[model samples]
Target: MPIYQLGQINTAALQTPGLYVQVVPPRTRIINGVPTDVYGQVGVASWGPVNSATLVGSPTDAQNFFGVQQVRKYDLATAIAIGLQLGAANQRIVRVTDGTDVAASVALKDTLGTPVTGATLTAIYTGTVGNTLQATITAGTQQNTFKLTILRPNFTPEVFDGISGSGATFWANLVSAVNNGLSGIRGPSQLAVATIGTSITAPNTTNTYTFAGGTDGAGGVTDSTLVGVDGTSTARKGMYALRGTGVQVLNLVDLTDSTQWPNISTFASGEGVYGFTQGPVGASYSTVSTSLNTAGVDDWHMKVLVGDWVYWNDTVNTQNRLLAPATFLAAQCAAQAPHVSTLNKRLGNITGTQRVAQNQPYSGAEIGAIVGARLDVISNPSPGGSYYAGQTGRNSSSDPTRNGDNYTRMTNFLALTLASAFGYVIGQNQTMDLRREAKSAIESFLLTLQQQKMIGDVNGGPAFSVQLNAENNPDARVAAGYMQADVQVKYLSVIFYFLVNLEGGQTVTVQVSSKPR
Candidate 1:
């Protein structure tokens, strides 16, 4: 027998049962509302208590104690605990009512004449009234009854009045007068004042007064006041304006300094005014004054231009600093002439001899041309027409000399013309062919600059190439590849190729290469 041929077999270990037990002592009862002492033993058969016992044992011993006698005990603590549990499990019921005006001393009772307990009540008291009593009940038999009674308050309202009279009567009369005066005063212009009496009366004999019509008699006024005693001290006369039915009275108490009054000078005419005139040309003292008053003439004086001709002191003065309309027009025409001849002397050029042909006349077209030429020269003189023409000036209104209209038109024309001229110049200078070549050169130079900056070079050396290819061509592709390994030329490498279909077509062959960086 060969002993070396035997091999031993092994098995895994078996698991043991894990069983355990715990015993807790049964609760004891209270004696006279105090806890009572009880004894318990865990080993064989030891037990002495006045309460119930709990026993748990191994499966083999469980049957022996299954029929053992058990008892439960109770005291004050046990009774309270049981009562609480019963109350929590029982259903609750409630009732509510408004007791706004009930008396505080009333005793509440249920149907069985039993006083209810454990009840809640709420009361809301308002108005000029006193407090009230509110009651609630929570008895099992009478849960639906309620009572309420109101108490009187101790306050009352009082009317207010001043030295004038009762406030209510005064206010009533005032409102009536204001309503009746609406036709004369219009809207709310009449002051409202109430009187204590049924009708308003004028002041008494001791008071002095003035009347609306400047009259001085007693019977002439509808309602009047006693003015004074006669010369013989026999009779009294009315001196104040009468107060009558529906007559408005102002209360001095409410008067202030800001009251409005009628203006007396609403349409008065005076100096320092301007309007149409219909009189002699030069009248120092005429029935109607000149429309251009003192103020107007003063303003004209301040605005007079130098070298203006004017008529002053009944004589015309050339070279005056103030010019009326006629004189201003004459001066303008004279300015268009060429030159002034010397008076009573050796020969000289006559006026208008050397005047520019374009500005010699005062016609509309001539004026327009002269003004346009002047503006072009001063504001937008483009040297030899190389620079674009910006806005020189414009005539905005029928009256071309109006300052605001002229300024606005000039500004608009300037902006529009400048933009148009700029576009024209750019189109003429930057042709399509030159722009294309320039763009290509700029792209190449940027790429070279980026290379010199070593932005993407792995070896910290200048190496770059321009990439060129048709954007949408699928079969034909070209790329310029350059590296610092070849140092002869730093220009971009050029790679170009085309795809062609062969006869009896076969698989295509792709070509790629590298050149200078």
Candidate 2:
């Protein structure tokens, strides 16, 4: 009669006479349009004859199968960027005090507030009355303004509740926030850029010359006589020019030596020829001069050239004055924004926030509560309770086992149920822990890198790759099958990227993947 329909046979005939069967194993059922098993028969039963005409099966199992649901990977890059933003926001909350006009009229004070001349002063004030100064006689002496300035760091939370958002978008917004916060800080007047050119020859020594004028020798009879007098002979004694006018020259002499000049006694014998008549011996004196102009055009050109060089050199100072303030603000904002964002992100996300709230300690009470809730749901009369209804007969009222199969299948099924219920929670928690460690390491690296000033732009920020060893963790372990089949979970690898920008434009990308451990 109806071929002894063994829980509704799938085929008209059975392939084997005896095999354990149900509508189908829950694991074999389709979920989210994907068959749970890649290659396996799902639903209905078959037994008895190889080809039986009376066997019948339900149409729903074959026609209405769905696919299994897939889990999502964590976004590490986004987490890092968010953390940085949080740090920035925290930094901004601290005040920055100005010391510019504090002592303009009172001969400036040192950082200690002791009155001093030509000194620089900088201080922060929280408005406590302990160190308040009294009014003085000077016009601007009552400069009791608050010295502390407060800035808000950049930070934003990622909205993961089926909303549209990304790490890059969040970072861009964070950068903008930081820039805005820092814009209020006063900046330097100029920014300087320096350049050096090729060198020229060094200075050396040179000489100058002079000459003497003279008269004819025959004219000495009345003035002095010219022995071989031509009609042009005349008597006079004067100095004559030996070198051209306005010629530049250098005179070389050894200050340490005194005997280099001619002796006066030798010169009086007329051999030195201070004066002589023209006949066999011509009247003349030896002297030296330079051709290069060392004084007129040369001195003027050198002085003008040096003055121009000095003027060009001053540009660097000017530039520094112009750009110092803006650059300082930009760097401060950049650093602060990323830190704030990171903190906020960690606090706002489900896994991250929960772990942080719980203070990173495992709570047995919390775990027990969750397990108790799950047990209650499984025992209650829900639509899916029939699968577990038979368990009530096998064990005590508090602990039940599967009816048909031994405790092995029953335990496996329970464990599977538990996993299905809390898999997300486990993954989230594990991810949070790994992320915390990764972030700490990254932050340390970033601090060091910033000091080096290695990265030039926001696009070139630091990145991290994390490999999580989560397979052996308590959250992932579960019993299965007759031989204690450990439900193995795949390892998750995450890459985190970071960026810093001066103009409030920064972005980062993170990619995550899973692999069997």
Candidate 3:
């Protein structure tokens, strides 16, 4: 007998086989759950590429990429800082601009006795942060040569040396050095780009140049800019840039335009993103609720907040700033597990809210109006009391069944997880074994979710059931290359009210057991 492995030979034709060791691989696949904590924030910033998604891990990372929080509207860094403060990590930040941004530039003069222009250096990114860049030219160790040093705050200086040339050649060499960079000594300049103008002689001493005329272009930014275009991959803009970034939760920093709610809701629905938005700053509950209703913002995927814009200590800007409720609510929701509801969860790093700062809390009627509108808010003296927490974690849905934060988020989480894990089964052979394997994979995932308490039993019944067999995939459907799966999951509900029934002392008899009472 010859040694053989599974799939290497047909066993029925192996009449001369010596030792057949067939290794059968496991067919049942384990579906891993997708992360529900990554957050996506889209807004204006002082620095960073526009319409591009960049992952930032901490407040410092956000500042490093997008600049520090500014005392202006539509500030992306401020929103990211707020999210980080509330324990949200793994954020995808996308910057937006008004399309009027200009890069900072400076002209170096040629040593033509009268000193004609030699080269112009411009920042690569179009923002005011480029204005802070400084370039210096100093005599190099090689005779009649110069060294170029580019500097920016909180970054390593890029230096290019060993310059030697004449006339236009000198400027070309310098430009090439800054643009194409040296092979080993240094890489391309991160602060600026250089274009050759005219040649210059080596400076006798050091001279520093500061960039000017850079514009942030944030002044003219409107709601449309933040909503952005979902053009082709290379032309995608604003929040659309976050596509395929796997950001489970998202928000447009301080976006209050009621007209764009449907657009954002559509994007969220299509992208499987759970989004947060807020009413206008200092807007009354009636105004917010009416505006939401009129705007047709009733999607379970979008959570709209009201009456909880907070006064945050803007330590970066050294001022008190009013932040949107979505900033805190979205971050808290992103930080939580998918099954955990945002209801009554304490907010972090908040100084005061509009209600708290004004010594005004929502009355029963006001809360009723807000909840009746299916909007959520962060306020003090919540069910948790004293500390600020999400007071009624409702999404903007008229349907009461899908209004809860847990319902929306858990559904998205489970659905996305299944969709993400089941794609591998598409091209497999249409056999009962394949169907069984697919069924087992889905059942295994649901079992994991149930064991983790993400889903739960209802009245002693199983938390979920999945059907992916010949019964669901009948002869007609299977002949047409259609495989069907029927799944039903019971999500654990949030406890909005804990009611107690009490009987009169004189009429009721109390029973006590010695075990604990």
Candidate 4:
């Protein structure tokens, strides 16, 4: 018998009674534990690099990298706040700007009203904010030294002190001064880096220097324009550009309206391409579901679809408003992850009241949880609230599991880890030694899950089983290069109801007979 690739074979990869996979996305590396604080957030910046995923450390760093929040037509400030709330302590986020406009730098003219020969003040980025900036050159205490002060919106005067007279370092000096001054202040600035040619630095008697002809250019500014970049440019555009960045476990938080939703399915089918979505979908479950289906994808097409219509403490508005359909779902996940990190736990309902979350309806107030095939969150409402934390995974209506990504990810994680390990350690040999090594690894991993109370043999039987022996590896099949691993996990679903009947005044206490008539 000739050997066949795992996909080419028709027989069960492993003849177990549980779960297994015929094909696994190719994965080369397998690190045991998961990673946190790694997030990709895209939105508009008043000033900063565009389409580039620059890692930032703090809110100040965020302001430095992407400029202050300018309240664009489309905003993601809410997501940023939520991620921060969920443990942004040591996390470094990849910050990106959706803006594609050009920098507005124009010539600084001389005292005679003529254009200065050498330097021009360019706002560190492109946008209308640059138009609001004006630079003034004033004399210094020293003979040739001078100070250039930049007036900006909602900012104190940024005084670029100690500039030299010679035209040699004027541009460099100005750029350095602007950056230094900007950093010292908390408010972000449109004035960042600069370039200048030969310029007469003779201190002007009038403190203000004249600059002219600065325009933001005709570029996309609205929500669609911000997210519509096709990523053809090397720097790329919007979230589409971030598809291949290898920024693992994205959590796929959408801050830019709902535009971040549709294209996530297109993030390239890579083995490690795993993440979750907190669709700030400003609409209802049906709406989000309809959109995903119409786009030819389900909530579980490639990621977990967690439905939430509310987010806490609007960073921009400072109002704890409902997320409409759902927007801050990512934040909710982040806030609640410590309780259960995508384990087979249900979110039930975070809101403390029955049929309410955050003082709103327990879930959506109308529905208990989301219906149909996708995985969703809702308030159980019986004991106040508990997000139906039992079932978690992004599954479609056609899927019987009905669980969200928790279980699926477990199976996938184990399967892929095993598959990759087997491929690397065993090579092409389909022998008994190969089967033993694979089985050991699978059992060890499963045991760890059981110990953690994640999964187990609750029924006094194997909650899960792995099979990879002579039966699966027939004499005809072993030669072709296929080793089957039929593994199954008995996921424990959350019990929503427990029935008990009470016949009026019936008591079992010993005192009941003495009190009876």
Off by over 4 Å in 3: 1-26, 140-145, 161-170, 203-205, 504-508, 513-517
Candidate achieving the largest TM-score: 3
Q: What tens digits encode model 1's per-residue C-alpha lDDT throughout 1-517?
A: 2122111211133254442232322222111111000111111111111111222222112212221111111011111111122121111100000112221122222223333211111112111111222222121122321111111212121111111212333324233433333334233211111222322221121211111111111122111011111132122121111111110111110011111100000100111100101112221111112222221321100111111112212121221121121121111211221111101111111111111122332333433442332211111112223221111122112233321212322222222322232232232333333333433443454354345541234445554433322332123321222111111112221111236875553665655567754
The global C-alpha lDDT for each of the candidates, from Candidate 1 onward, is 0.20, 0.19, 0.85, 0.49
Predicted candidate 1, C-alpha RMSD: 49.5
Error of 3 at 290 (Å): 1.2
lDDT of 3 by residue, 1-517 (tens): 4444546787778676377787776887999988899899999887888899998988768866788788888899899988888889889999999989899998887545677768899988888888998888887778878788888888778889877676678778889999989778688887788987755454424467889889888999987888899988889998899988888898998899989989999999888899898888888777888888898878999998884688888887899888888888899999999888898898867878888788888887777878898888788888867888888888888898998988878888888888898787687668888788888998999998888888986566789899988678889999898999999999988898899997777868888888952
* Alpha-carbon deviation at 142 in model 2, angstroms: 84
Per-candidate TM-score against the hidden true structure: 0.11, 0.11, 0.92, 0.61
Task: Give the C-alpha miss distance for residue 392 in model 2, angstroms.
Answer: 46
The candidate 3 region of ten consecutive residues with least summed lDDT is: 198-207
User: Which candidate should be chosen as best, given lDDT against the real structure?
Assistant: 3
Clashes in each model (backbone N, CA, C under 3 Å)? 10, 69, 4, 43
The alpha-carbon RMSD values of the candidates against the true structure, listed in the order shown, are 49.5, 48.2, 3.1, 11.5
Indicate the TM-score of model 2.
Answer: 0.11
Worst 10 residues of 2 by lDDT: 303-312
Q: Candidate 2 local accuracy as lDDT?
A: 0.19
Full-model lDDT, candidate 4: 0.49
